[model samples]
Target: MAQTSSHVDSEDTVEYWLFPNISEDGDQLQELEAFRTRCFTFIQDQSQNYIWHEDSINLKVVTKRTAGDNPPHLYGKTRYGCNVEDEWFIVHLFRSFSVTENDVVIRIVDSDGDFLLVEAADILPRWANPESCINRVFIHVGQVHMISIADRPSSITPLPSGQPSLMDAVHIVRSMPHLTIAPSPIQEPIRQRIEKCVSQIDSSLHRCNVFVPASVAALLQSYPTLVAPAVHAFCQRDASQLQVIRAMRFFPPETRVWTSVTFTKCLYAMLVHRNYQPDHRTGWTLPPNGDPKRTGSELGMKLAVGFELLANEESLHQQGGDYSLEMDSRWNRFLNTLKEKGFFQDFLESSQPYNELLEKAREFYMNSVGVEGPAKKPVILRLMQSVFADIEKFKKEEAHLPADDDDSWLSVDPATLDQILGDKFGLLGVDDDEAKAEILPKLETFLHRKSDYEGLTPSSGRKKSRKLSHLAPPSASRKTSTLSNTSDVSQLSNHIGFDPDSFASAMQGILDFALPEDNWDLESNSSCLSSYSEEEEGGELVDKEMNNYMQTMDQELLSTDVLRTSVDNPTRKESVMSEGCESFSDVENFQPVKIDSAALESLLASYTMQRGGPGPASILLNQLNLPRSQISASKKQTD
Candidate 1:
C-alpha cells in the first residue's frame, strides 16, 4: 500500500476520503437538516453503539442555511440564510482513526435500520502500518443515471464501502443485513465483488433507459461487483425498469416509485468531488486534459469539452417530459459558474453538434415535402417552403463558427448578426421595418427577464398574450371594425385592389362556368332556396306580419340596384373618395343615395340583350311584378 501525507496550518492532513452517497442522490445534495435529524436521533436512541466503556463523547450539530429560500429553512442553498426551495440528500462518513491513541469505534445504521456502517480507527497495534489501514477504506461510490419515468431527476448513489479489503470485508460481513433475499452465500471473495461492481458502473456514461431486475438485486446484495457497471449502464440508457428485489429498498408503486432513478444524482456528486478543487490564491484549477496541465484559455477548452459531453443528450429526442434533456436540476448553476468566468459561450458552442443534426433534418424534410426543383416552385407554396429552407440554412450556418477555440461571437455587434443572417439565409431574413418595430420591444423585455422564462423564448410568449387579448372589451379589440356603422363598403374595393368594372367582368366569367339552373339539386334538396318570408312549415298558414316583413325585404332589394350602377360604373369611386368618405359604410356621405328604378331597369335590359343572352335572367324576371303605375309614383316622390 502507498500513502502520501500533507501538512496544513500546524496540523497533519491524515487522510481525505470521498463518501459520495450519504444523503439523497443528485450532486453534492447536502440536506444537513435530514442529517442532523438522523445524527441526533441516533445519538439519543443508540447510545450503546457509541459507548467506549464509560468515556462519553459529545457532538454539536449546527444547521447551516441558504439565502434563496425566504425563511432560510426552505430550499437549495444561500450565502447568508436558507429556506429550502428544493430538497436534496447525500451521505458522507469520513474521519481519522488511530488505534495507538484513545480511539472510538461506532456503527452508523442507515435510516431503514437494515444496514450498519462501521467507523473504525483500528490501526494502532503499535506494529501496524497506517498506510494499509487507510487504503482499506478507499472503495469507490458508483452512480446510476436514470431512476424511473416518474422521477428520472433523482440519481442513485452506491455506498462508499461497496467493496472492502479482506480485513475490512470481515468487519462488514458481521454487521451486514440478515435479509431473506439471499438464500445462499457467494462463493467468491466479497471484496472482489464490490470492486468489480463499482468499477463497471463508473466507467461509462449515457442517456438511455435502465432496467433493474429482482434476480440482479439479490445477486447485488451478495456481491458488490455488479453495482458499478449496472449503474453506469442505467445512467447511460434512455428509460428505467424496476423489478422486485428483497434486498434493495423496495417500495410498492402505490406509494412511491418502484424504479430506481437516483443514479445521475449520485454520479454528479462523484464528479464534483474528484474533478474540482479550490485554490486559495488564484481561484481554482478544473481537471485538465492530457495529464500535464497547461494554463490560459486551454483550461476553458478542456472544461468546455467535459461540459459538452455531460450535457450531450438532446432535448428534442428525450423520452418522457420535455425537460428530460435537463441532465441535472442544477444545470444552470454550472452554467452560471462558467458564465462568471466568461467561458459560457465556449460551453454553449460545444453543446450541440449542429452539422450532424442539420444533415439529418435536411434529409427528413426533403423526403416529406415532395418538392423536386427550386426554380419550378409554385407561388402558393412559396411562404411555406421558405420556412423549411430557412430551417436547413440556419442549421448549416450555425454549424460553421468564426473560430474553434476563440469565441468571436461573444462580442459581436447585434447589427452584424442581423446582416450576416440576411446575407446568408435570405429566406429567414426579416426586412420589414413595420414587423421589426412591432416585435422588438417584446423581445427585449423577455430577454431582460431571461432567468424567469423557460421552455420558449420571450417573444413567442408575448405573441400568445397578444392573441388572447381579443377576448377583452370593445375598446380593447381590433383597431378597425368591419361591422361599425361608419365602415364604408364602396371605397373598400379600391383598398382590396379591385374596382366595380373588374368585379363585373369576373362575375361574367363565373356565369360561363356551368350556368346555375332550377334543375340542379332538385332531387336532394331538403330546404328550398326560393322560399319567401311567408313560406309554410308543416302546412301551417303564414301570418300577416310575415307578409309585411317580405315587403320590407323587397324595398331593400330595390336599393341593391343603387349598388349595381356603382358596380357598372367604377369611375364613381374617385368622386366618392373626393367626398372624404373612407369607412366600409360611409353612411354620412353616401348611404343616402336612392336607387333610380327606371335607370336600373334600363341597365338590366341592356345586359340581358348582350352576347351570352339572359337565358336564366328572363325566366327570373317573369316571376317579379313591375307595374308602370308604381314606377310613376316612385318618380313623383323623387320630384
Candidate 2:
C-alpha cells in the first residue's frame, strides 16, 4: 500500500493544537480556560467531520501568547495560587501544511481527555475560493467570532464589478402593493334634498307671509350641514322635531298662547339661521339713526308727491269737480300766503305748505267735479283780499309769529310758485288782450332776472344764451335801467312831452279814475247805475238823474284811462284844428307855450287834490326848483 498523508494538506493549510496548562489563578489563565472550554464544546457539538480525537494525550499546542507553555507546570497555575493538574492530549495523526502569520489555530482538551482541533484561515471571506476547504472553514468561522455558526457561509464568491442597473430597483418597487388617493365622496342626494327645501322656502317667503313646512325642512338640513352631527346629536331628536322646537323659540309667548300657533317661532328661527339680527326683546329701542322723522329723503319724497298733486290741475279737477279748479287756485294762493308770511324757513320749507294744501286741493280732481263750483273770480279775489287784510291786522297788533329755527321745515322756491300759478290759473295777471300786452313785457323781464339772479352758467358745452328781447323797450336799452326807473318824474316827463309836475299829476288822476266806483252798476237800470238821488220826484228824481250822469261820466273816464294807460293803448286821432288853438297852417304863430302852461297848471292843481299831494303850490314850487339843464342831463345819462 502506498503511504499517503494521514491528514490531507494543501497550499491553503490549517493547524490544530491544544492549550493544556492554563493557570486558573493567573490574570490571563482564566480567560484561556474559558476560551478553550468554549471551543471544545463547540467542536464536540458540531458534525462528525469536525470531531475531536478521543485518544490524544500529548497535544500539539501552537499560540502566539508565548513561544511555548511557561513554568512548565502540568497545567497553568490558578489565579488564587491554587494548584491545577495539567492533562495532556496527544494528536493521533499530525500533518503540517503551509501556514502564514495571519492564520490562527485553536486546540483544547476537555476533562474527558478528548482533543479539539479548530483551524481558522485569516484571509477575508470576500477573497477566498469557495472550492478550497481552508477558505470554506474560514468563511464558516468568520473574522468576527460573535457571528452565529448557523449563519456562517459554506463558501465565498467574488462579486463581478460593473455599473449597476436600476431594473432591479424598478422591479422591487413594482412588486409592492399600490397606494391609491381619491377625493372624499359627497352625499349628493342629501345635498339635493336640502337644496330643494331651501328653494321652496325662498319661493314661499317671496309670496306668503307665513313660513311653510318646506322652509322648516330647509333650515333643518342647513343646520346639519353647518353644525357637526356630533354636536347636533346632543339633542338626540330628529331634524323635524328640532325644527319645531326652534320655531317655538322664535314665536312670542303671547302669540303662541293666544293664537295656539307657532309660526312666529319658525320665522324667528329662519331669521336667526340666516344671520339676521332683529330686536328680539320686548320694547327694544330702535336704532336712532334709522328714525323716519329725521330722514330728509322721506320728507322730500312726500312733499314732492304732494306738490305734484297740487300742481296737476286735471287731477285736482277730477278729484274736486267743478270747484276743483278754483280749489286748486285757492291752494296755490294759500301756499303763496304762507311763503310771503315767512312761515317757510327756506326754499325747502315750501314743501310744508304744499303738503298741507294737498288735502284742500283734492276737491279739484274729477272725482270731486260734481261738487258745486267755487265762487268765481271776483269772489275769490275778495276772499284773498280779506285773508291778506287779516294778516295785515295781525302785523299791526305786533304779535310775534312763529320764527324759523334750524329744525323748522318751512321753505319756498320761486320755481315752485311759478309751477303752482301756471298749473292752476294758466298764468298770473289780467287776461284781457290790452292788459296782457301792457303787463306781459314787464312780467317777462321781471321773471328773467328772477330766474337767473345768481347768474350761474351751465358747465356743459351746450349752454343756453340769455333772451333779453322780452324786456320792455325802455328797460331793454336804458343804462342802469329797471322797471323801478319807469317811475322817475323827469324821465316820464321827457318821454311823454309834458312838464314833470304836470305828468305826475296826470298819472295820479288817471290811476284814480281807473278804479271801479263802489256805486257803479253793470246793469242799465238807472237806480242800479247810480245811488238814489234826492232830486227825483221832488229832489229825488233830479238828484238821481244827476247822480246817474256823474256815474256815467265816471265810467267813461275809467274806460278811457284803461285804454290810455296801457302800453298797447291805441293812439287817438287828432283834429286838424281846435276851437281855442290855431290850425296847423298857422303853426309859426301858434303860441303853444301860454296854452301848454295854463293846461299843465290846471291839470297839476286837479291831480294834487285827487292824489293827496301837499298842494298845487307845492307841486309848482317843486317843478320850478328843477334846473332847466338837469332834465337834458338826466336824458343824456339815461341814454
Candidate 3:
C-alpha cells in the first residue's frame, strides 16, 4: 500500500487507509487496493465539480481540488488528477460509500499551514502544533480527527538502518484506524437526513416559516448537524426556532444547548471576520461571497465545515445552563479569544447582526430555563405590577379613612368660603349694577331656602358673625308685586256706554259695503248654464233674454239718478219713484239707448282701478259706495 509521509513543508501530501468494520467480516487490506483504484477513478470524474452526489448510495460530498506539479495520470480511458486531491477525497469516500462509524477508511490531511490553527494557537494541543500535526489530521466518518505522534502504534520489527522508516509510519497509521474516535453509529444517517433537509431550504427568507418537526428534532438530538443550517435559514425567518431548538434535550442536557451556542458563535465569528474557512488547518478556504442567493448546496458545504469543529472540540462537552448570564459569559469568552487574536478591532457590538445574535441567544437561554429562571417573571413587568399594586393599596387606604361632611361649611374660614362660593356661583366679578341688583335677591333667597332645607336655622349671633358684604338685602318693592294690584276689566266694560240706534246703523253700513265673494263651487252656475243650453240649440234665446233684462235694469238705474244725487237735494225720493215708472215705460217701448262706448269703457276702467277683478254684482254694489261727485261724473259721461 502506498502512504504519504509526514511533511510539514509539502503542499500536496495526502494518504488513505481502510479500517475494517468490526461488524463486517472481511480482509480490509485486500479491498484497500481496489478501493483506492475506484476512488482514483471517482476523483477523476468528480475533480471538476466541487460538490457532487452519488444517487445510488444517497450520499453527497463537497470538496476542493487543486492542480499541483503532478500531471494528469490516465485511469482506464479518462485522465485523473490524483496527485493534487486533498483529504476532502477521504470525506467523500466515507460519506458517498455510507461507511459505518465502526468501520471506515481514514485519510490523513495536513495543510501544514492553517490560519485557524494560528488563531487557536493558544488552545491547540502541543502535539497538534504546526510542525507535529502536519500530516496527522485523520478524516474518519466525515469528521476531522487528530492522532498525536505519542499515541501512534510502534512497529513490531526493528529497522536495520538507524534512520526512521517512512514505510513503518504508514503501516502503523493504516493498522491503527480504531485508535481515533469513531462518531456515533446513528450520526451518519442523521447527517444525511439533515443535509437533505438543509438542501431543500430556499435562500430567500420571505415567507419562510421553519418548523422543527418531531422527526427533525429526534435526528437533531442524535446529531446536531441540523443546528448550523437551521440557524442560517431561520436567522431571518423565525428567531423563535432558536428557542425551540434550545429546548430539545440530549442525554446530557447541555449537549443540545452548547451545540446550538457553539454553532451560532462560530457562524457569527466567521461573519464578523468576513471569511469562511472550510478547513483552516488544511489550508482549504471559502471566503464569504456575500451572495444572499446562495444555493442550499453552497450553504451545506459552509455548514459542514464548521460542524466538524464541535465534534473535535472537547471543552464544549461541559455542562452549562441556558441562562442569559451563562450564555453571555460563554459569548464574551469567545469574543475575548477573538479580541486576543485581534479579530474585532472596531466592531460595533450593538449593530443589527450582532444584536440579532444576542437576542436569539437570550431567547434560547430563556426557553431552556422554562419556568425556573428569572425570565418567568420579567423584571420590567414585575416592577410595573408592584407600582400599580402600591397605587391600588394607597387608594384602598384612602377609601377607609373618614370622609369630609357635606355640612362642614361652618368649619371653613369665612373669607375662604366666601371666595370659593363667589367663584362657584360665578359672582366674583359683577360690572353691571342692574345684573348685580337682579342677582342679589336670588342669592339671598337661595341662601334662606338652603338654610331651611338643611334644618340649620342660623342664629342671629352666627349671622352677625358671618358678614356677607358682597351681597345686599333683597329690595322690598319688587316689580312683581305690582301684578297683584292690577285693576279688574269687568267694571271698566260697564263704563263703555253704547247707543243702540247708532250701533245698528254702523253694523248696517258694514253689511251694505261691497266685498268680493269666492265662488269656488261652480256646480250651481253650471246647472243654470246647462238649463239655458237645453232651452235652445245654440242658446240664442237665452242670450237675447239676458241682454234685454240687463238693458231694463240699466235704464231703471239711469232714471233713478241716485248715482248723481247730492246730500243737499230734497227731491231725491220723488225723482226715484218717477224714474222707476219711466224706466218700465221705456222697457215696453224697447228702445235701445245709443250710449257712448268710449264713456262706458272709461267707466269700466275706473271701476277696475278702484275694485281690482270682481263680478258684475260686486261692481254694482261698489258703485253705490263711491262718493257723490265721482258717481255723478261717471253717470254724466255715460249719458
Best by lDDT: 3
Cα lDDT tens digits for candidate 1, 1-639 = 111121112121112212212222432233432332233233223221211111122222122222221111111110111100000011122111211111111222121111111111111111112332232222221211010011011212221222233233223322332210111111112223334433443232211111222222222223222233233323333322211111122211111101112222233233223332222232223335554222222222222222222222221123323332135434334334334434322433323322222222232222222323321111111111212222233334433422222223335586676456444323242333332232222222333342434223212111324432332323223211211111122232334453333465466566656532322211111122223322566332343344345445545654675545532434333333231113222323323222334443453444234322345332322112212222222322323
lDDT of 3 by residue, 405-473 (tens): 122322558567645644543333333443323323222332333334534332211122123322322
Ranking of models by TM-score? 3, 1, 2
Off by over 4 Å in 2: 1-412, 428-639
What TM-score against the true fold does each predicted structure earn? 0.14, 0.11, 0.19
**Model 1 lDDT at residue 132:** 27
The candidate scoring highest on TM-score is 3
Q: Regarding lDDT, does 1 or 3 come out ahead?
A: 3
Candidates 2 and 3 compared by TM-score, better number: 3
Positional deviation of residue 258's Cα in model 3 after best superposition, in angstroms: 50
Residue pair clashes in candidate 3: none
lDDT of 3 at 60: 12
RMSD of each: 35.9, 60.6, 50.2
> Is candidate 1 or 3 superior in TM-score?
3
